[model samples]
Target: MINSIIKLAFGIEYDGTHYCGWQRQREANSVQEELERAIAKVANHVIDVVCAGRTDAGVHAIGQVIHFETKSERKDISWIRGVNSYLPADIVVRWVKVMPNAFHARFSAVSRSYRYIIYNHPYHRPAIFSSGMTYYDDFLDIDKMQRSAKCLLGENDFTSFRSSQCQSKSPKRYMMDLTVTRHGLYVIIDIQANSFVHRMVRNIVGSLIEVGCGHQPENWIGNILLRKDRQLAAGTAYAQGLYLMLVRYPLHYEVPQSSIEDFFLIPLLS
Candidate 1:
């Protein structure tokens, strides 16, 4: 008897510029559509994919995780190449592996980390039509931005920083960590949370930019949280600069990559 279910984890990357996002929509291009189509051709059957999180249009992911089940037995690792052959160059499956039957990619996630990159030089704006990153040429005070970001570290009603279009019933979220770092002209903002609401990260970045620009007092973030008003927040940061970096799960669900050691050549002479 052919096995009924084969659990697999897939690492995927995509240039979301032309797509409407990761989810399906009417006449809208999406990463999910491309992936499902590729899988159907290879497995010769319809398959449903479950992802750790949804990425908005123009966003990017260096380590996005997803899982799916198929009734057919996978023959070998060449499945990656076979799938890639049909998928667009912008969308590629890095690899796939059999996971425990009980492992779930979405619900089992413990945390998610996102990295936002911005170019802060007047002449260093992101490339034209570059939909995967944002460019802000004005000078920003990184130290002030970091200080303002600290007000978001604890659990709070993020209504102020969320999009008005958000459909989530509640706006409360616990921010695990938020850091702003500067490297030459690039300002990197890293955020970790148990979960995030729609537009939360972008809005937070927008608010921080306002503080960094001295348009708002340093205590602005705290005031917004206390105010709990969406109108109090600044415009959403450009979607292109955000990336879903990593998804964390319980220790038992930890993924192991044997070849990672080989990828980093340790000195044999040492």
Candidate 2:
């Protein structure tokens, strides 16, 4: 008799401060590597996980989603509790569910969102919210940043904003939304897209910061898109400030929904 196959989906959040990235790397410690080891302890067998996005080193995530298949039959809560028992304190399994055979953590997702948090205060650096935040000492014009970001809202070839090491075949990606807002001493940049190129978020943020800080004109953003040259854009921003805020799948998948607003508004006070 053949054994039945069980596919599972999990929601996880991680503080990526000390992690090399989401993908397992041979030379460095990785979140995926650590999570897999924890799962192996519970399953008593090897298991591979597929995540919605492969965040870069030092990047964080609040609503990362992953899927894996296992032979062992385990309760939903058991997967959470069991996995948590073995994982480091920085990683947490928020939810677990049995996914339909067709569900895929990466492919089934409709869109992904990221938030880049910037500490704009020139004199004082924040004690908390430091792990995934970028600090800028220059005075930034919020109004110019908002208008400049509007130029990136529609589908376009993002070659200028993609990394040279990117493996995607095409630089084209659809931009669902891009918003720049300020809350007290923090400037939050929220972006959603069908997908992204490697370091695309950081690259875009870097250019936007140039505009925000008066290094470039508001219209310069559109001009950079036209150039299609990576060298013409600003340097990629630090990975510390970027967060994989959420990944959205079709409602049919029955996965939980997440809000960008609530997640971004958490108090930074330690």
Give the best candidate by lDDT.
Answer: 2
lDDT of residue 236 for candidate 2: 94
lDDT of 2 by residue, 122-210 (tens): 89776876776999989888899999988888899999999999999999999999988887778888999999999999999999999
Measured by TM-score, the strongest candidate is 2
Regions of model 1 farther than 4 Å from truth: 256-270
Cα lDDT, model 1, residue 262: 32
Candidate 1 lDDT by residue in tens digits, 40-115 = 7888899789888888998887667889888777654767887889999898887687889889888888878888
TM-score for candidate 2, please give it.
0.96
Relative to the true structure, how large is the alpha-carbon lDDT of every model?
A: 0.81, 0.91
- Report how far residue 150 has shifted in candidate 1, in Å: 0.7
My TM-score estimates for the predictions, one after another, are 0.91, 0.96
Alpha-carbon runs more than 4 Å astray in model 2 = 264-270
